[model samples]
Target: MRFALFSDIHGNLTALRAVAAAIDRAGPLEAVVVAGDLVQGGPRPRETWEYLIEHGWTLLRGNEDEALGADRIIHGEYPPRFRAAAVAQITWTRKMLGGEVLQRLTGLRESFRVATPAGDLLVVHSSPRGTNDRRGGQHNSAREVVDGYAGTGAAVIAFGHFHSNFVRATAFGLLVNVASVGLPLDGQPIANFTLATATSDGWIIEQRQVPYDRGDELAAAARNEMPPWPASEATS
Candidate 1:
């Protein structure tokens, strides 16, 4: 069986289209899963959410997605250093999405486990510990990376949140970050996704990058009057 996994779309329809085309080109995928961050932070948030809903992709909730249904932060719920612009974006996103979209976003699951020919695949927006686990993505070193999934039961842990693509192996199991579909922070202007094929012997994982005209996305963001910080997840 083959599975196509992508995450952190962040509401860029152009990038999503390019990734979809790439998936078609890579054809015969058993399933397509959007790990999280389907909406918020760019042009056409409604369109992106609708497209994902229409296509019936398996979805998970990201931090931004959770914020869509939440009230503005009054307490110290998030990082103390979190930017005001991000808070503003979340507020604007919640207003733009309205009640219906917020309901949809709220319905997304926090994680998913799939049985594959190779073994079990655990998919989550961040680490299995929870959605707010920063260590899952922002590991300081290789040992920290290995320690992040110390007790996960699955043979493979697939997650997205850091917007960087990497596959790592530890004594516990294998961890894969499928990266971002809309906003990649790896200094690359390309969209990314991962394909995992299970065989009798083991599992084969391939990361696919599709180059699309980011200028189009930028233009859309400008036309929508979205904040400039929406362009880059890492720097923003």
Candidate 2:
């Protein structure tokens, strides 16, 4: 099966559109997997979400999704490990979102699974174990990703959150990070998505990045009363 994996859209419609156009050019995909943070920070949170969801999406819940589950986030409730920046970002995001949007966000799952021609595939927003899990990787690190699914058996394990894309051969199995489709930590703002295909050898991974309109996204975020963040999730 050929599946498209995308994450951390963060309401950047231009980026999302560019990515989607790229995917269309790439051809028919078995499924499109989203790694969370569908809305919150960018040009059009609600609009971006509608496109991602209404189009083709195999979705997973991110930490920001959980925030929506709460009536109000108590500063003390956040983990001690979270940096001040992360906390501030969360504070701003909470206000930018409405109760209904939060309700939808809260309903997303931490992980997702699909039957592929190669085998069964698992898609996690952060880490398979938990959304908040941050596992570091590639250029940077984050438990929210690789570490979340320490022990797992699957033909391929794909996740996003770290914002860095990588493919690794681990003792567990074939681990691939589709990276962030919104804000890339590599100093590039282009979005990315991955297409995984089952071959006789095993799983073949392809990473693709799409360029979006950052100015439009930034404008949308500024219009919102929320904090100075990019997209969805606390990081947005």
Candidate 3:
């Protein structure tokens, strides 16, 4: 079976569209899975959310997704971690999404598991432990990362949050980080996703990157009064 996995599309509809087009060109995917951070930072929050909903892809909730339903600002949960600007953006995003959409966002699963002929595939926003684990698959050692998913029975584990795409093969299985579809921090101004295929021996993972016009996204941010887009990385 072949499937597409993408994540961290922080409301950049242009990037999402570009990635979707790339995936379409690849064709005949059995499933499309989004590992979350669906909306929150970029301009077109509602439209991005709508686009994902329209596709009916399997979605997982990231930490940013959790913030949509959190009363952080109301409870004075800003400062050290969340800044004033981030809070403002979240407030604006919530307003743009409204109650119904926010409810749906809140209803997303934290993690998803798919059983394939090869083995079980696990997808999550951060790591198998939880959505807030930002370290994910990148920071940890190969063995450490593989060992973290010890009893999950997943032959392949995929995730996105750090916005850095990579694939690691350990004695246990493959740990793939599909990376960001919107705000990529790997110094490449392109959207990214992973295509995984199951085989009798193991899973074949490919990291696909698609270049898109950033002009529209930047213009949208400016029109929405959003803060300047980061040159390298923003707190996701």
Candidate 4:
């Protein structure tokens, strides 16, 4: 069966909607899975949550997703600049989300596994082991990527969080990164997703990039005046 695998939607309703429309056009998809970081990027934190819930997305909790429910981001002895940004965004995210939505975010797990026509498929925000792991996002290597899911007993693995993209074949099976539906590595930023399934010949995967009402999303972000970082080619 075909499934739409998407991740890191980050509150850009335009991007999400574009991808959703694309999926509708491309279907008959059997299921849908979102790896996470579902909100706290563009604007409309609550709206994004509601939309996803209404659409019944199979969800995984991202780092930002978890931090939104916390009292504050955990400041360790040492953290990088980007991590500090994550903390600030998450702190703001907690404020943006309502109690019920925050609680729902809190309830999300780091990963999930299911038996699909394509054998066993695993979904996680980053990797099967560490939610914050960026090990695989760098090299674009399958063996390296699958290393994170080594003991998970899953044949196919899908995840996001690097805002990058890669598809690889490993000893276990196929490793696919759904790319980011909001932020992206090409520096282009528009949203993208992946379709993965098993085939008699082998496993096949496809990447899809969809267009949306960027001007509207930007207008909302500008109105909110949230997050210090200005919009860039890769982010909005």
Question: Highest lDDT among the candidates is held by which one?
Answer: 3
Candidate 1, residue 59: Cα displacement in angstroms equals 0.6
- Give lDDT for model 3: 0.81
How far out, in Å, is residue 60 in model 4?
1.2
Q: What is the C-alpha lDDT profile of model 2 across 1-236, one tens digit per residue?
A: 78888887766677778888898898887888888867644545667767876885777777655654553343243455644544566555555566676677788777778766676788887666677655635543434334655566676788877777888766566778887776677646578889888866678899887765566655665676445532233223
Candidate achieving the largest TM-score = 3
Per residue, candidate 3 scores C-alpha lDDT tens digits across 82-152 of 46676777788888899999999989998888899899999988788877664445668755665465567
| All models, RMSD in angstroms | 2.7, 4.1, 3.0, 2.7
Best first by lDDT, ranked: 3, 1, 4, 2
Ranking by TM-score: 3, 1, 4, 2
Model 4 residue 222 CA deviation in Å:
2.2
Please say which candidate is ahead in TM-score: 1 or 3. 3
Candidate 3: worst 10 consecutive residues by lDDT? Answer: 227-236
Winner by TM-score between candidate 4 and candidate 1 = 1
Candidate 1 regions exceeding 4 Å error are 73-82, 141-147, 230-236
TM-score: model 4 vs. ground truth: 0.87
lDDT of model number 4: 0.74
What are the lDDT figures for the candidates, one per model?
0.78, 0.68, 0.81, 0.74
